[model samples]
Target chain A: MKEFKYVITDNEGIHARPAGELVKLAKTFASEVKVAKDGKEADCKKIFALMGLGVKKDQEVCFKVTGEDEDAACEALEQFMRENL
Target chain B: MKTYSGKSVYGGIAIGRIHVYKKNESMVRREKIDNPDAEMERYERAKAEAVAQLKGLYDKALKEVGEVNAAIFEIHQMMLEDDDYNESVENIVRTQHVNAEYAVASTGDNFAKIFAEMEDEYMRERAADVKDISERLLAVLGGGSAGAVQSQEPVIIAADDLAPSETVQLDKDKVLAFVTVHGSTNSHTAILAKTMGIPALIGTDVELEEIDGKFGIVDGLEGKFYVEPDEELLAQMREKQQAELAQKEMLQSLKGKENVTLDGRKVMLYANIGNVKDLPKVMQNDAGGIGLFRSEFLYLESDHFPTEEEQFQVYKTVAETMAGKRAIIRTLDIGADKKCDYFGLEAEENPALGYRGIRICLTRTDVFKTQLRALFRASAFGKLAIMYPMIISVDEIRRIQEIVAEVKAELTENGTPFGEPEQGIMIETPAAVMVSGELAKEVDFFSIGTNDLTQYTLAIDRQNPRLDEFYDPHHPAVLRMIAMVVENAHRENTWVGICGELGADTELTEEFLKMGVDELSVSPNYILPVRKRIRETNLEA
Candidate 1:
């Protein structure tokens, strides 16, 4: 398993559009990706889960990946934060 | 010849054969299929074709409008792929031995009926989406063309109501006017029409089929549409259209010029914006700043209260758009009138008179503080001013100021990057007007919210149909209160702006200029005309 903590940078937080993008990205990897904030976890693949997280800009959260491609998932998610977050 | 009258939300005349677009009703037809294997194959083919057609529609929408708006089609795409819809259609095709078209149509009709019965207006509207998807599926199964309306040069597009996506597909050059049976000022279609500068008449009960292709003149500014205009009236309308065009050209010429009076006094002309979507329009008008950025839109649409960082991003976008220009953000002013079920604010017997605006903010310090902190953080990007709405007394002003100071101190302690934005009060309440001098001394500036000022000063419920006649902003008492507030703010050497509908009133522009209002924040459509009015006036006298 691999994990990384990061802050939400998008102005709208994890709104429907950004959440959809995140879900699409998660589906591409073999790892089971999940996001947690304020001690609550949400499946990274479900758009509703990300939206329900109510993550706002500058709010910090952690992403965890566990599976065959955990390393790849972590690397891709980190790059996503660096570019589009 | 028949005639009917209704509120003309947009203005223009049309002459043509009435092209009545009847609302599509779901149709259910059944046929016997001899082979279950062949029926299953038909269902699979139908689903594939429906998905492809949906993608095609989405592609067209994306190309014409943009991704953000095109995203609405994703819902329809999801409905097409829903397992329940697929299973229901397959069951009908296999058990009843029906053709693919008939099976798909039956399933769609049932689902659409269910959705139409939903209480939520947003969900009810999804019935149309279901019908649209089903129509595409049936069309594919029947080997017919996809049921997409081609962009045509229609002189006047008449309908019961137009979806935002459909409005976007309209050809601006050919579409001289639009007539609809229902729509409101806030509808996305209306907003789009306004942006496109097209003449439209909405909420008219006139049978659209009767006047679809008729020559008439529409006066959007006056909310009047003349069908089959007489020659004399057509001539007059032609002249008016020419004058309006010339005025638009003149305003375009004055785009980069500062809004200065004939006597050389400068008055800032700013845009009143509701969301970041309006930022482009504000910039297009060459507005000096955002006079009133209603932050309620950010909170109203969200399922929960927006976090400080989320608020900061929206505020930052506005600040960056304005660059060095000021963006005055009013905190969430939701109350009985603009109710949010999430906030648990009950409907009041008298909403306008009840707990709202600054009162809500005062009682809900956590909400107010989060917004204040975000505003401070965004201030680093550009000029930002925080304005409190519905401020009724000096006490409220002092209290909010204290809270702002506390937030600033906390941010400093946490080493969060932020700067203190200039704080101000909206002179809306009668009490606020009476205490303007004192409040002005405490705050950086004053903005007269004439809508609420008129409502409270006259003790009339503006939203009540019975009291609408008495809710006039032109009432002498309302004018007197505004004058008092403006005078007091000036006496304190603090800038005062008029940001309500009164700012856009051409009849009162000279009077406001005479009263020495430092700024006029209005809708983008009125900016040029107001600027022209100021230029023609002798303010020094």
Candidate 2:
């Protein structure tokens, strides 16, 4: 499993636009991706599940990936979080 | 006559018969289905229809509103395609043996509840999106037409609150105006009204039953809705509407005409804009140039200080849009009544006389440098000018020049191409006017901000309603300062312009021309009227 953590910097925590974008990015990878905050896990590919996490500003969340494309998914998601979330 | 007041989205007069819009009735009742397979198939078909409808609305919104507002439709399409939501409907239809409409409605309720219960306020608002998309599906399943306006003639649309999709479905030609009991200035209805160039009122507390089909007038300027107005009121409003239309036609004739006096003395008539959204109005009014582009919106709108690239893109857009017409952008004028939380500005007893404008910029060199870098880089795109506000001394100008020199030197080191934009300062202070000769020699031009000049000279707080009677712009003291500044700027071979509320005061147009004010920059709406006034005046007379 490939895992990494990121803190959301956007004033609006995991807003519809960026959350939708994150789901699109996650769907591109064959890896089974999940986002977890405070021990609760959500499927990264699902917009509603990811948004349900309610990861607010300055709150750290962990993304875990398992599959052939796990390395690429981790890199891409980390980059996306920094740029958008 | 009964009158109701609401917030005006666009200013003008709209008088027409009222047409209270009502949403489609979609009361889904659970029906027993013998074949669950057929019901699932029906649910799938309705979902497809809903998606197609959303796509069509997306395209329509894209054309009517810009991409930002149109994006909501695209998001709705994605939400419709959500696997969990569709599975829930399919499960309910297959297991419970219910009709497609009931299954879809129940699924919508469950998902909307999930979003509504979310901890984040923004996510909670997404509940409405869920409801909106589900409602679309329900409408398709029930074989009912979505929010339709049934009217033979153009009539004012009064509603409780219109969804984005409903607002887009409205026939522009058949809709005279919009008045809603619940909505905000940023609502889709308001934005659509603005794009359509029709007067709209929001939050008007009026019963639809009483006003439907009634002859009513929407005075957007006064934010008043008059139902069954008396003959005297109707006559007054009709005359006012006629005069407004006549004035608009007359102003349209002034387009492409020079801002010149009968005696052949010419002056530059420009527009003051807050952002690029006002660019259309600026062009429509035939402004010679953009005299004052307030840059405060960049900082005020953002949660953090806008990065250099962000500021650069905005400035570049204004430059490119103006197409060589002079665009004078004032550097960040924060503090005072406009406060940004990220700036960490302390609450002052008197913010007006406290840390604000150029004072904040001079103190915070890092923030100032980032903005200067962006402004200088954007200058290469068009005839851009930079102006500093809240100046009272020659030393401050010199300090700013040194910083500009440093910025230009750094840009050269980095090999970034930037044009040398004309630098100017606002002469809004009495002290600046007193020492105008020295100040004029330091800058390329002078733009007198008469509103601040009047307030400062009269020692009256412009924001204080109690001082409205005492606050006077026509004080001889203020005029004398302007005249002195003009004379000094002329001696230094520097051009001068008036860019404030007083510039648009038609009564003072000739007086300003007589004082040799080379330019007048007012709001876009007043450009043509001021131009007409300037054309009629014979300075020699």
Lowest lDDT 10-residue stretch of candidate 2 chain B: B61-70
Interface RMSD of each: 7.0, 3.1
lDDT score for candidate 1 against the true structure: 0.75
Candidate 2: misplaced stretches above 4 Å?
B34-45, B118-122, B143-145, B209-211, B245-271, B274-293, B297-329, B334-363, B369-524, B527-541
Taking chain A of model 1 alone, its TM-score versus the true chain A equals 0.94
lDDT of 1 by residue, B294-350 (tens): 999888889888877678777876776576788899988888878777889987987
Cα displacement (Å) at residue B146, model 2: 2.0
lDDT of 2 by residue, B91-164 (tens): 99889988888888898889889889987766776777787788888778778767767788889889888777
Q: All candidates' TM-scores?
A: 0.55, 0.67
Q: On residues A1-78, what C-alpha lDDT tens digit does candidate 2 reach at each position?
A: 999998776657787777877888899999999999999999988877787788888899999999999999998888
